[model samples]
Target: MMSPGSRPLIPGSFLKIMFNQAFPGRPGVYWFLQGRKVIYVGKAKNLSRRLKSYPRQAGFDPKTKLLLAAADHLRWQGLDSEIEAILTEARLIKLYQPHFNLILKDDKTPVYLTITKAVYPRILITRQTGTFGPFSSTRTLRQILERLRHIFPYCDQPAGSRPCFYYHLGLCPGACIGVISRETYAKNITDIQLFFQNKKKRLVASLKKEMLNFAKAQKYEPAQAVQKQLEALSYFWQARVMSLELPRLSQDQIQLELNQLFGFRVNRIETYDISNLSGTNPTGAMVVATHGRPDKAQYRLFNIRSLATPNDPAMMAEMISRRLKHSEWAKPDLIIVDGGRTQIKAVKKLIPADIMVVGLAKKPDRLVGVNKPLDLNTAAARLLIQLRDEAHRFGRRQHLRLRSKTLFI
Candidate 1:
């Protein structure tokens, strides 16, 4: 029997009865039961440690408040290794559709730069998979395409074709007319791939030296052109470079950063903004940003549910209440209302005390909290502004688009 204050990992009076009757030692996976239904599933290396975690005061997160309220009883299955336990946890979560798990509904189709696997490899912008270059921006990729054409100098035409305009303009390596040997052409392709794979610094330096030599030898026009191409290549490289730091931060780091700056740790942040013309179609927008980046898919637009037309603060409060009722959406680390003190206070009335809330006033960009105006120069303040502004932009665009459509209809 569990001790006083040691509530079962899964909670409910009915589930508590069921859990007490069952054999508690065997552990492969655990399910959190609310009455007869399993709301969450987990695999435990040790059933005791995993089960104890749910009821422990220090182990709980503010976001897990709803889960704790709904929890009733804990059930488990015996498993071999930690790896198997992790795999089992994932499989069970997928099967159960737990409210706490982060669901990835959005497709992960990022754009890529493809070089066709051919003798005279032609470069093309495509979305097809199995390609090496997965560039984030099309504009950056276009710049890369230009630099590639200069460095590789492959033929735009078929093998037996006549020298094209590129060759006439001295851009091609004369591959179309077979002036560049097949061996050399193949070497160029290899070199191009190397550059794309971040092996370009040395090669670019060598190319620059060659261009300077050509300029000294009275080939002034070509040298200047090469110099220009080099500058473009340098910019292309800088834009696509990614940080080599740790991909995802730990929860401790997140909490520490938030606490030191904001006097509280931020688990999630929900920002609200109202968008409308003068007494026209007023709509409220709620954009959520977790940690730092905008989770656009989680963003929502509200077509003022209340009959109180043109009341922006009321519209904001309604949206907040409606969103708060949903079990899946976690309570925000901070609340950002996109208006002055009035809007901030309105939202505060709607939110529960477990969460932190603030507002960003547009003019001079100030943060309006419960008692005092937060200084905007701190790291947390900057992050709060970023989220608030993003919500404003998202809300404004949605409002404008809806208004435009209504006008058209």
Candidate 2:
């Protein structure tokens, strides 16, 4: 009897071998192995598509190539649903320690924007307990806290403290001083919770109506304040959600594809875009997104140091290489460069083939891969373009911020 650890490697006989062995048709976790070593661990709703990817779509990555060369066996465990698959994958990866997966050190504790789980839950920025976030950055967590406070004034003040600074600054709705009624405060908190639960459009529309109402009552100051807040919320929503030509793929499909390609489901994707502005500052920026939402905490600004003059491609390559060398930053499943064929080719050489890479040509907003340009209308293409655009926006914002700071200094 062949031990599971010593399964025979029949060349060109994978399908025949797996045919006799049960491959779970249902959603669940799967593992590819080279004798005793686990090469990659993944989850899938359709085992056929997930298993097929190993041989059919296994793009060459240094680590994947080695795994493929040695892989003699495939195995899987069935799951109830796709969500379970994700949770299972995350758990197994933590336990088994696969080499291909981009596993970061779990040393740093997560900080959360906790609205205390109390009768009158107070909003606070903390690393303490109770529904803490695995948030990408402090800035991002703070922004979320601010938004929550604006929408639900009840959470803005300390539980027992007097009117806070926010009240004095006219940012809070004066909930701390009883200026806002309990019913109104509760309604606001309910709206905020609903928004966080993915009812953004509804919340935005409601806010718009309220803003108009204040204006109609000749309450110009309050109306302007509400309008400004609405604009900010709109900007945040647009930045995070992709409005595309194609019907958006469900979150599960996107997550599964990402996991298969990169060996893990990418939560925060950080892309680096370099720009020269006529070779003046010659800067590079690292932009971050978490679960398709902008995670500003991971955003980074860099002054181009390697080259004296402007070189967007080379500079971008160097920045990416440096970022990958660090263990703290989560490696993106995809690296998006903002350029045409030439730009893609240059960065491609620098990137290890294992990592999925693509370039976005700004002229037509096209995605350029190894040999062909993908049409952005396709679901896959749209997702890639969104990542590239995010990187570009982040880089541009950093460039402007640095330029303004320099002028002031």
Candidate 3:
């Protein structure tokens, strides 16, 4: 994607190098800084993959593009899980008040309704277990529960002799007075869970039925209450979505798409390309794509070691052997070798038979493998082509860097 009237903060080889150094492939919060002052804060499940796509942002909002264009340095802190990343991001944004982080400005932690497994079932707003929603909302979240309480009255306070706060407010079904039975209370909690899960179709249908039943029985007041509940649900849903514009594809969603197209579950893809002029200053570059996204952090370069002759096959095999020796580096789902039958034959022996390998022929532009050749037009084919292209670019860059260094020395 191209952005009009703006440019990337760090483009080209410098951008690739910065992504590797600043955003290691992990769940983390990254800060975009310009001369020591932080400008943006973003959280990602895979920092390397996300950062690599910044310069190529297709539909980035104006504010986001501006942040990237203004930033001079990148900083990040790794987290354990997506959940942890979310929580940390919220905290970081609040602390820094970063100009680009428009969300989490309110001092409010996302309100979640927790239904504890108890005799009377205590429903409390918290960020603890059995809770639902870190759902982004400034005002509508509390209004939803308040309006919902009229139709499905449950308690958010401890049962006591005196009526609890919500009970007195006419928002609870007197859980403090033991008016709600366990079986019935569980059903109410289930409905709440359904609402939180965004199963609004069933919830809305059920609510509509109750509203109609009340209307028919001449229970006008209760029916009016139910009508209000429906309105609240619809309003809350609309408001929550309107809080943010349509989001970009998340890391999980990207992986899901890749998994679907690749004919198997693919989390990692590795591509290799060899660059040299008749075997002098030969180098093989490895580029990694995690979850269908390029991850510059794992990209590597190899100098030809064992091969003295100008044999591409031998050079590729040597690079593969060295890469495979580092068991700590995460393995790949598929490997793209930038050559045809001869290259595949040389390297296929080193790779396990179970692993998928493909060779791309420049002359025919055909994907060669054990299976039928695929045109470089399909999504999967396009992905392989992208990997191959990136590997070639990286290898050439590294080769030039080596050449420049030798000349200077």
Best by TM-score: 3
Highest lDDT against the true fold, candidate: 3
Q: Rate the local accuracy (lDDT) of all candidates.
A: 0.60, 0.59, 0.67
Q: Rank candidates by TM-score, best first.
A: 3, 1, 2
lDDT of 3 by residue, 216-255 (tens): 9999997876786676455434332212222244667657
Error of 2 at 91 (Å): 57
What does candidate 2's lDDT look like per residue over 136-205, in tens digits?
3466556555434543455366344587656643356666766776666665666665544445567778
Per residue, candidate 1 scores C-alpha lDDT tens digits across 1-409 of: 1221223543244334433443334335667667767776665545655555554532456545556566665567665433334435545554565654432212434355566777767556676342443333455456445535654565666365787756643457777777887776775666566665544556677668868888889999868766655664553333321111112445455446556766666667788888766546667788886765557888988776564457777778877888888878776777888877788777787788878777776423455665544443234544566677677677777777878998999
Worst 10 residues of 3 by lDDT: 238-247
lDDT score for candidate 2 against the true structure: 0.59
Model 3 / residue 52 / CA error / Å: 38
Cand. 3 Cα-lDDT: 0.67
Itemize residue pairs with steric clashes in candidate 2.
61-354
Q: Is candidate 2 or candidate 3 better by TM-score?
A: 3
